[model samples]
Target: MTIQKIIRLLGRFFRPISLKWRLVWRLVVLQVILLTLMIFILLGGLTIAGVIPDNYEGRAIDVIRNTITKDGSGNLMLKQGPLLAELRKEVPNLWFIAKDEHGHELSEGTVPPEFKHITEALDYIGDARFVAEPGGSRTTATVQWAEDTAAGKVQIFTGAQGEFHIMALVSVTPELFLEIILPVGGVMAVATLLVIPLVVRSAFRGLRQAAVLAERIDIDERGVRLPVERIPSEIAPLVRAVNGALDRLDKGYERHKRFLIDAAHELRTPVAILNTRITSLPPTPERARLLQDTARLSTLTDQLLDIQRLGRQAQQFTRFDLVAVARGVVVDLAPMAFAAGYEMSFEPARGELFANGDRTAVERAITNLVQNAIEHGGNAGRITIAVNSPATIEVSDEGDGVPAAEREKIFEPFYRLRPRGHGAGLGLNLVHEIMQIHGGRIELAGSDRKGACFRLVFAQA
Candidate 1:
C-alpha cells in the first residue's frame, strides 16, 4: 500500500488507545533511535581505545598499493613518503612483505623472521589473517593480494601491534549489536515497558480525577472544580483556564435564570389583568380568541417560573405510585378538556405501580404532557393518561400524531411543529429536563392507531 494509507491505518489503530499508550509508544521509538546511534558510537570508541583492531586497514592497503611505483627501470619498489608515514601512525608497528607472481619481493619494516616460511604457503590464496604466538608473543597479521597496473598481482603480508583499525570494528559490529547490545537493549526495553504503566498511572492521577469531576458537572451541579493540586505545571494552566471558564459560565447561567424568573414574575400581574379584561368582554369570536391567547400567555409564564424553581429543587428521589399521579393529572385537566370539546380519561393500573423520582417533578411532567395534548390534540378528540406496569405513564391523544420528521426536535426548547401553534414550546423541553434529572427518559412511543403518544419511563425504585 501507499505510505499515506499505511499512516492512516496506523493512526486509526492507535487512536482508540489512551494517553498512557501513546506516551509509551513515543518513548519506545526514541529508545530504538538512541540504541541505533549507540551502536556506531560504541564501535568508534572501542576501536579508538585499541579494543578492536585494524580499523584503518582499508586506507593502509590503498596507500601501500597506490605508492608502489616503478623507479625508471620498472622494478617493484615500496616508495617512502608522507602517505606511508600516515599509515604508520594509524596502524602502529606496521610491517609488510610484498611479493609478486614473477618471483620479485620488496620487504618493509622489521620483517618478522616467523613469517618467512609462511609467505610461500599463502601464495595459493588472495587474502588471509594469521594469529600466532611466536616465542611467547602473540603475532597477528593479514595476508592479502592487490592487482596493480604497473606491478602484477602484489601479495601484501601486513600486521599491526595496536588494535585500532576500521576493518576490525566493521567485522565486530554485527556480533556487538546482535549478541551484546541487542540482548541488553531488549532487556532494558522490556523492563522499561513493564514499569511504564505504573509511572503513567501515578503521573496521570490528577487528570483522571479531573475528568471524573468534569463528567459529573451537569447543568444543576454548578461550582464543581477539578483537582489541580500535584498536577504538572505544563497542564496546570489548561486546568485553571477550564475552571475559570466554568465559573464564568455558571455566573452567566445564574444571571440568565434570574432574568427569566424576574420577567415571569413581572409578567404575571399584567397577564392576569389582561385576562380579567378579556373575560369581562361580551361573548364573541374575537373575545374567545383573545381569551385563548391570554391563557397561553399565562401558561408560558407559569412554565418559566417552573423552570427556575426546578433548577433549585434538591432532588430526593423516592418510590411512589405512578397510578395516583396520572389519575390526579387527568382529574385536574378534566374540566379544561371538557371545556375544549374533548373527552379526558385516566386508565390506572390494577395495583400501585412504583417508580423512583421526585414526586412533585413527576407530577409536573405528567401535567405538562396532558396539557400539551389538550392544547394541540385537534381539540375534538379524547386524551388518555394511562398508568401501566413497569413504572411508566403514557399520554396519548386521539388526534393527528406528531409528524415522524419532527419527533426528535419537538423535545428541544422553543421547537414547534406548527409556527403558529399555541405554545411557547417550553412545556415538552421542561418535561425532558425533568426526566434527565431523574435518570430516566421521555420517549416518543409511536402507535399504529391515530394520534401522538408520549411515554415517560421512570427509574426503578
Candidate 2:
C-alpha cells in the first residue's frame, strides 16, 4: 500500500469510534510495537548475563558432527550430503578433522598446516573456539566432541565462526519462536486485553452521568447543568464551558419570559376597560365590530399569561372535576356567544369525572378552544362543550370543518387558515403546550356538522 493509505488505515484503527474499542485497539498496537523492542532486550539481556557464552559455536559444530560416518571401507570419513554441501556454502574456506580415541583420523577442506595433524591431540580438548592464529589465513576455528553410532568418541575440529545467522537459526531451530517470542509476548497481550475494558468503563462513568444531565436540559427545564466532577482533566474543560453557555441561555430565557408576563399583565386592564366601553355604546354595526376587536384583545392577553405560567402551574396539578372545569368555560363566555348570535351549550359528564391538571391552566385551555370555535364556527350552529368519559373535554365548532390541508398547521402558533384577523394565533399553541405539560394531548375529531372538532384529552385522576 502507499504510505498515505497505510497511515489512513492506522488512523482508522485509532479513531474515536467507541471509547472501549478505541482504547483496546490502541493498546494492542502498542503491545505489537513493544514486542520488537522486547525481543532485542531479551537477546541482549541473556548475552549480558552470560547465559550465552562468548564463543558459542554449537550451531556450526553440530552441523559438522552430524555429517560424520564410515564409508564402505569401514574408515571414518565425512559424508558428502546436502547438509554438508550447504555448510560448505556458508563457510566458503571450510575444513574439519575428526578422529576417535581409537586413532582412526579424517580431515576435510584446506585445514591450516599447524592443525592438520592435531586430530590425534584432540583427546584432551572438550570444546573450544579460537580466532585466526599466527600466520593463519583462516578467520576462526572450533573443536567439538561427539559420540556417534558408527564413529565412537569422535573429536572434530573445523573452521567455523561464532557469528549468528538469524535466518539460519530460525530455519533450523523452532524453539526460538515456539518458546520465547510467542509465549512471553502473547501472554502479556492476552492479560492486558482481558483487563482493559473494565478499566475503561470505570474511567468513563462520569461522562455518562454528564450526558444524562445534558438530556434533561430544555427550555422549560431551567437551571440544569452538566457536572464535571470525576471527568478526565482533558474533557472536564469542555463540560465546564457547556455549563457556562447553558447558564447564559437560561438567563436570556428568563428575561424573555418575564417580559411577556409583564406585558400581558399590563394589557389586561386596558383590554377589559375597552370591552366595557364597547358593550355600553349604542347598538350600531360599528359598535359590534369594536366589541369583537376588544374581545380578541382580551383573549390574546389571557393566552400570553397562560404560556408564561404553564411551567410553574403544571407542577402544582391537582385532582379537579372535569364537569366543573368545562361548565365554567361555557358559562363565562355565554354572553359573548349570545352577542355573536350563537347558542353556547355544555354537556357535562354523567358524574364528576376527575382529571389531573392545574385547574387554571385547564380552564384557560377550555377558554382558548371556545374562543377558537366562536372565531371560526361560521356564526351558526350551537358551540358544543362536552366532558366525556376517560377525562376528555371536547370543543367542536360548526364552521366549515378545517380543510384537510390546513388541519396540520391549524394548531401551529400564528397559523391562520383564513385571514379573519381576530387572533395573534397563540391560543392553540398555548393549549398544545399546556396539554403537553399535563401529559395530555389535543386531537382533531371531525364530524358531519360541516365544522371542525378539537378534543382535549387529559389523564384521568
Candidate 2 segments exceeding 4 Å error: 1-16, 54-56, 66-97, 100-102, 106-180, 183-193, 269-283, 313-315, 334-350, 446-450
Q: Which candidate's TM-score is highest? A: 2
Q: List, residue by residue over 1-461, the lDDT tens digit for candidate 2.
A: 89999999999997768878788878977886688567656665654443443333454567657877777776887667888777766666666777777778887667776555555567777888655455543355678788754566788887653344455443533665567767776876787788898888889999999888889888777788887777888899999999899989988998999999999999999999888878898999999999878877887888788788778445578898989888878889999888887888788766789988888888988898998898888888889998889888889877788777787897888787667878888988998998888888999885455687899998768
Q: How many residue pairs clash in model 2?
A: 0
- Global lDDT for candidate 1? 0.81
Worst 10 residues of 1 by lDDT: 49-58
Model 2 per-residue lDDT at 408 = 81
TM-score of each: 0.72, 0.74
* lDDT of each candidate versus the true structure: 0.81, 0.78
Q: List the residue pairs that clash in candidate 1.
A: 53-163, 54-165, 54-166, 55-165, 55-166, 55-167, 56-165, 56-166
Error of 1 at 412 (Å): 2.0
Candidate 1 on 1-461: residue-level lDDT in tens? 99999999999987787878888877777786788678878767865654554445456667778888556765778678999887777666677777778767777677567766676776676698776676766566778889863576788877756554456566777887798778877876786788887898999888988998999887888989988996777899999999999999999999999999999999999999999998999999999999989988999999889878775344566778888878888788899899988998788776688877788888999999998888788988889888876778899998889887888799998888778988899999999988887778899876576998899987777
